[model samples]
Each structure stands twice: as C-alpha cells, then as structure tokens.
Target: MSAIPVTIGRRAALSLDSTPVPAGSPLVDTHGRVHRDLRISLTDRCSLRCTYCMPEQGNEWLAKTSILTLDEIELIARVAAADGITTFRLTGGEPLLRTDIVEIVRRLAAIEGPDGRPVEIAMTTNGIRLPEVLPGLAAAGLGRLNISIDTLRRDRFHELTRRDRLEDVLEGIAAAAASGLRPLKLNAVAMRDVNDDELVDLVEFAIAHDAQMRFIEQMPLDAGHTWDRSRMVTQDEILGALAQRWELTPVPGRGGAPAARWTLDGGPHTVGVIASVTAPFCGDCDRLRLTADGQLRNCLFSTTEYDLLPILRGTSGEWEQDIDGMLRACVRGKLPGHAINDPSFLQPARGMNAIGG
Candidate 1:
C-alpha cells in the first residue's frame, strides 16, 4: 500500500486550550453508565520503544503545539471532577517527561470529587526515573503508582523494551515504595515465549516488594498493528503457571475492575490478571480516555474522537454548553465492547501511547 496524506476538514480541526468548565450533572452515557474514571495522557514522547507500544522509528510525532497545555489538562479534569469523576490516572509516552507535571498534580489535587472527598490521583510509568521524581510526585498528592516491569532478567528486559535500564527501573521502584506511595502496583505484559517464563518470578518480586502485581494480556494497541492472538499469553495460561508454585483462590466482586484478584494461599499479598484481550470487561468499563491532543475517547478502541481543543480555544460564548453536550454525545456513543475477538474488529488508528495508556 502506498502512503497517503490524511487531513481533517476544517470543521473538525478546531483548537481549544483555554476553555472553562461550567457546573454540570454527572457524565452518563446512553447505556446508563456513569463515568467515574478518567485517564489523561500527558505527552506522546517516551524513553523506551517497547516493541508492543511504539515502533522502532518513523513515528509521526504530534506537533508540540498540538499537545494539550497543562492548563488545558487541568480544566478538563476539573470539569470531569465536578461531574462525579473521582479517580484520575495520568499516563504518557512517559508522563514524567513533562516538566510541569508536579505543578499539574498540585493543581489537580485541589479539585474535589463529587463526594466532596479528595480525588484519587494515580500514574502509570515505566519507572526508570521514579527514583528521581517519586518524592516530588508523592508530596504533590499522588496516591497510587503502577510501575511497568515486564521482566526480572536484565537480558529479557532489554529484549522486551529495547532498553537496558533494568537496574534504574528497580531503583525507581524502591524509591516509589520509600516515598510512601501506598498500594503500589506493577504491570507486566505477558507475551508468548518472550517473558512468559518470568511470570511467577515477577509475582514473587511484587510480593517481596509489598506491591500488587498484574499480568496484562497483550492487546492490539501496538503501533506496528501486528498483534496476533496466538502470540499472546492468555489469562488462563498465567493462572495455570502460577498454580504450579502457589495455590490460587479467586477473590469475589471483580466487577468493573480491570484485574480479577486472586489470593495467594499462605501469602498476605495478592496478584491480579487483566484479561482484556481474552475476557474484556468493557461492559462495565467506567473509564474515559483523553488523548494528549485533547480528543475524548469513550472506549479504548473507539474509532471516533470528540474534539474539545477547538471549543476550549475558541471564544464561543456557549463553550461550556457545547462541551457538556459533546461529553453526553461521546458517552452515548460508547460501544458495548471493543469487539477485539470478533472477526469484524477494527484496529484503532493510533497506538496505545498516543491514545493514553
């Protein structure tokens, strides 16, 4: 196939970065699902070119000016907060790459949830630089940390992420623990014949570190778009592997949560498996994604995006009403599921990094 230039018509290419959020009711989709979780991507720039995430090269980077400003991010979040959204997760190509992130946290932490309680703020980072920034982040009101560590073996880590900073990642994990970021979570993407052999060891590492560990089934979010179901290590395989060494028991009430919890017999800590590819929980997925470019995605695999940038940037007198209406429409259009296992599934145009983790 020959490369073709793509362009959005002017009607769809407005910029919005200075709009304010007006008071509103909770954001509810057509299916009667209320939004409570928001994932915001800070930037699309990353330090590691994980094979499953970004390509080795030739990624058409978003123009720096096209990315949302911190103020813009804050305003969207504030509106979401007022709409009963209590949890916000910051993601990135690497969120820590943003220089103004701490200040961003400081501003967001000031927004109260609909319950009048402090909003729960969390982040997912590769952990290479956690040691240097964890303290600042913790003091700025970050409540949870999800560090991505796919392998304990240095060689395997290098093979997976195309980076040899395993030692730095380990140090960063320790720094996160020391900073008192409670309920630390570790994310490992399980790939067939790659790092599958290290699953149990990764869990044990998490147990020793007092962190909750989750093995995520690889999804079709890679920039390469070469995802094959046969290449993924599924949830059942993960459990069977864990059962070989540790007795496993399922935890109750796993609804809406991405990870299905399991108790490790004879151990105080637990482990989880996010079977997104095999057994998706999209029906109860209460999360929304705001891309770094200010597009609102109701579903992770949503083909369409609601652009809020132009509205936020424009001088329209009815910007708030426009935003509120757009939010309702996005929610109403949310698909019941991503339909990845079906033959008719359509891969998202952008990779996971661009979509927000």
Candidate 2:
C-alpha cells in the first residue's frame, strides 16, 4: 500500500537545543489540565465504511512501513506511562482488524504506570470482529470496551455503515458482555433525522444488554468533510427525547470524561451524551492521540501535529530524551478548546478514523 499524503497545516518544529523534560514530570498543558489518557491508533483500516467516517473507495491507506511497529508503540507508551499516563485507549479504523491486537494489548498491559500499577487499557471498536477477539483481548488485560452501533434497526445500520453486518455487531456486543468487560459502553452518533429518533430505543437496548449507552453529537470529523451543523443532533435534543420516555437524573462527578452522564429514572441504568460540538469538554480534556502513522495530536480539532516517527526512527543516541521533549512540547501547545462552534473554526485535515475514534 502507498502512504497517503497528509496535508498538515501546522507541524511542531523540534529544536536541537530543546531542554530535557524534568524527571517524573506530569504531562500538563498551559491551561493546567493534567494529561493521562493516551489514545493510540493501531491502523487506518476498517472492515466497514461508515458514511460518517470515510468513503467506500479512493481512500489511500498508510504503507505498512509508515505505520508504527509494536515495538515502537510499546516504547512510546512506556515513556508516557512513566510520565503519569494512567489510561491507554487503543482505537483505530477498527482496532480488531490488527492481526497482532492481542499481543499489542499484552505489551501495553505490561507497562506499569508512575504509581507502580499497570496502566488501564481500553479499546473503541466497531465490534464486527469483537466476538472472535474479545476472549484473547480479555485474557491480555484489556480492561474496557466501547462498541459503536449507530442504529438498532437492521436497515438503518446498513444505510449508515454502508455494510450489512448488524448481526455481527450484535454478536460482538453479546460476546463482550459475556467476556465480563464491566461497564461495557455502546457508542452511537446521533444525527438529526437519522438515528435521533432511536435515542430511547438505543438506551433501552443498552440497559437490556447490561451496557451503558453514550450518544455523541456528530462533529466535523467525517472524512467526507460533509458534516452539517444543522443536521447534527444536539445534546439537549437527545436529553429531551429521553426525558419524554423516562426521567433522567443527572449523575455527578464527571471528571475529564467526555460523557456527561445521567441515571435513568434515578437508578442503576445510565446514559451519557458526549456533546463534542455543543458542550465542548476541552477544558477537562486529558487526551493525547498518536495517529497510526505516529503523529502526536494535542487536541482532536488541532490543525497542528507533531511528527514523532522521525524521532522514533532516528539514528541519534538520544531518541528517548528527544521523544520526552517532543511529548512535553506537544502538551504545552494544546488549545484550550476545539472551537468547532467558533466562526473561525476549521475542521481538522484528518477525520475521526484516521485520528482514532
């Protein structure tokens, strides 16, 4: 496969005389948000071509050599873990598509955090292949799972994903639940006049499956760049729809989590809304994304990307120190918010799949 040429509007320029990061320093940005979550994209390949993610064809993928090797991923993850990164969320076009995913999880799970505990490893997958991989992943210390399912209706699923694999997704969800992945999450992107009407149904399905449902407001992260604000469902609308079906009591203590959760009918079952477009949780954001091709992204909507592949593959003896300095530099440059609602806001060059979910 040929490497796709990415047009990065901003690139982090590494200085030769950059100061070394202080020992045991926490990854904190200018806004004082302590970074910990590391979302790593293992690949840009997916089994399904969802309308909101990418087109069916004409999309160039990264060459195998350009993609980070497992060894490289481990080295970067270890550095982050030592720097106080406690959570690792493995994401991708579909992480299950990686042939060595289980081993990747195992290597990551072995890395201890600053506090001397193994870092938490989670994954966001489309779940088509989860049924086959869930067992090995669970055994390899995969802590949590988030499965994306847009609609409950079979026809709608096909319409949205451009694939007829709703049955496989459901099976994957069932397997995940059976594998004892506690607090299993189901992610559904709520679109206006699309899957918006099924908000209640989605929640009900989640409750029945013993999983928490999260409705996400569609942002301008689609590969097509065709995201329309008018067509995107807002958080308030989702809550309002659920309110008609059941009373939703707000759940407290949502620190750094993208989802603002509420208990349905004041008990047990809960539903969350990740209103990335309307609510904008960048203030509490602690995420740092490593693209499949090894670019470090400070913010989801950031136009800037720090290329770490060169440093990782450099013949220089000070690669570790160089990486540490780059990590610090990346965090220091994080924007306060995604600014998607601002008039000057420009959507990122890469879409959600390439950026990781």
Candidate 3:
C-alpha cells in the first residue's frame, strides 16, 4: 500500500527532546488537564449494528492494509507509556472481531508505564463474543472489562441493535464474571422510550452479577447523525428513573473519570451516569484516541485528526521522534471542550462506530 500523507501541522515541530518529557511528565493541555488514558481502536469492524452507532448495512470499513499492525500499535503504545500514558482501553466496532485480540492485549500488557509498572489494560466490547474470548483475554493480563448491553429484553435488544443476539451477550457477561474480571462494568446508552425504562432493571442485573452499571447519555455521534436532543434521555431523567426504585447517594471523588457514580441506597454496589451531553465532563477529560487506521484524535468530538500511519510505515530514520512529536502536538492542540452543547458545535463526519466508542 502507498503511504498516506502526514497531516501534522507546523505546531508539531516542538521536539520531544527539547521539551524534556520525563517519566510521568503530565501530558498537560492548555486547560491544565493531564492526559494519561489512551483509548486504542483495534478495528473498525463489529458484530452488531446498533441504530445509535451505525446503520444496519452499507457501512464502509477501514482497509486491511490501512489498519495498524500489532507491531505498529505496540510501538505507538510504548512511546505513549514512556511519555506518562498509564491506562489503555482497547475499544472497537467490536474488539473481539480482531483475530489478534489476545496477542494485542499481551503486547500492551507487557509495556511498562511511567511508574515502571506494566501499564493497566482494559477493554470495552459488545459482549457478543466475550464468552469465546474471555479466557484468552484474562490470561493475556486484561485488567478490567466494560460490556455494552443496552436492553435486558431479547426483543428490545433486537429492535435496538438490528440483531437477535441478546442471548450471546448475556452468556458473555456470565463468562466474564465467572472468569473473575472484577470491577466489571456494564454500559447502557439510555435513549428516551427505548431502553430508559430498563435503567433500574439493568442496575439490579449488574448488582446480581457483581458488576456496576453505567448509563450513557446519547450524544450526536450516530452514523446517521439523526440524534435529536429532545429525544435524548438526560442524566436527570436517568436519575429520576433510578430514584423511583431506590434512594441514590452521590459517591464522592470522581476525578477525571467520565462517569459520575452514586451508591445505591447506602453502600457497596453503585450505578453511574456518563452525562456527556446534559452534564459535559470536558473540563476533566484525560483521554486521547488512536483510530484503527492510525489517526490520532485528541478529543472524541474534535474535527481535527493527525495522521500517524505515514510515520509508522515510513523508513525515515526518525520514527520514534516523529511519532512522539506528533503525539505531543495532538495533545497540545486539544480544544478546551467538545462544544457539543454550543450552537457552533458541528457533529463529526464519523460516527461512534467509526470513532471507536
């Protein structure tokens, strides 16, 4: 495959050596936020087609040659780890779709973080194939898991995902629990009149399975760009639904984490809400995403992307330096916020599935 032109701008001219980024050097943006979490998309292919993520068909996937190889991914990750990135979340259209998922996990788990420890590795997957990959992933040093199941009802799941694989997802969840992947999180996109009614049931199911449930406010990241704010189930609405069944007390100390957690009734098992729209957490954002095709995205909603594929595939003697510079440049260029609520906010061309939810 021919090399794609690098899209890095003049701002990336700042050299890593000149900056002298030491271990744990806060990859600070202009907003005074330190970025340490790196979310990597293993592939742009998935097993299910959720209406909010993508259409049922006619989805264009990244080419095999265009996707980053396991080696290339490790190289970038190693650089990120050395530069203070301590947490890595492997996401995808469905990460399990990658044939080298286990090897990918093992490679990442082997990388040493800024503190000289093996960097923490986690994955967010639609639980359809979790049952088959759980043992391999666990053994590969996976630290945590977040499984997406929007609805507990089989029929409802089919309606939302355009697939009748709720049974597979449930089995996968059970398998993950059995494998002792503790602090397991179940993610549900709370859509008004869709799965909003199942909020309480989902949390109860999570508690029974020794997992925490997180309900996410639907953002305008759908493939069709058909997200209507009026139709979205807000954080307050989700809280209201939960309050009807149980008393929720706020859990303190939610730092850069996306979810604002609340313990149910009193103590122990808790529920969370990722209010990306109603209550944006951009001020505390600490994530940077690397697309499956090797594009670096500082903000999930950012209109800008810096291409890393060219440098990765180039025979240019300064691969490491170039990548490090590009990475820093990307972070340095991060916007103060996604600006999703503002009138000037424009939805990105790519949807959630393409962007690696």
Global lDDT of each candidate: 0.83, 0.87, 0.87
Q: What is the lDDT of residue 144 in candidate 1?
A: 90
Across 1-357, the per-residue lDDT of candidate 3 in tens digits comes to 123332222123353335654333457877788889999998888899999999998998888999999888888887788677999999998999999999999999998865678899999998888877889999999999999999999999999999899999999999988877888999999988888878989999999889999999999998899999998999999999899988899998999999999999896989999999989999999999999999999988988999998898887756666777788888889998999989999999988877887
Candidate 1 RMSD to the correct structure: 7.1
Candidate 2 residue-wise lDDT, 38-122, digit = tens? 9999999998898888998888788998999888888788778877889999999899989999999999999897678999999
| Per-residue lDDT over 160-274 for candidate 1, one digit per residue giving the tens place of the 0 to 100 score | 7888889988998888777678889999999999999998999989988889899999999999999989999999999999999889988889867789989999557899999
- Measured on C-alpha atoms, candidate 1 has an lDDT of 0.83
Q: What's the TM for model 1? A: 0.92
Model 3 has how many clashing residue pairs? Answer: 0
Give the residue spans of candidate 3 off by over 4 A. 1-24
Worst lDDT run of 10 residues, candidate 1, spans 1-10
Instruction: List where candidate 2 sits over 4 angstroms from the true fold.
Output: 1-20
In model 3, the clashing pairs are none
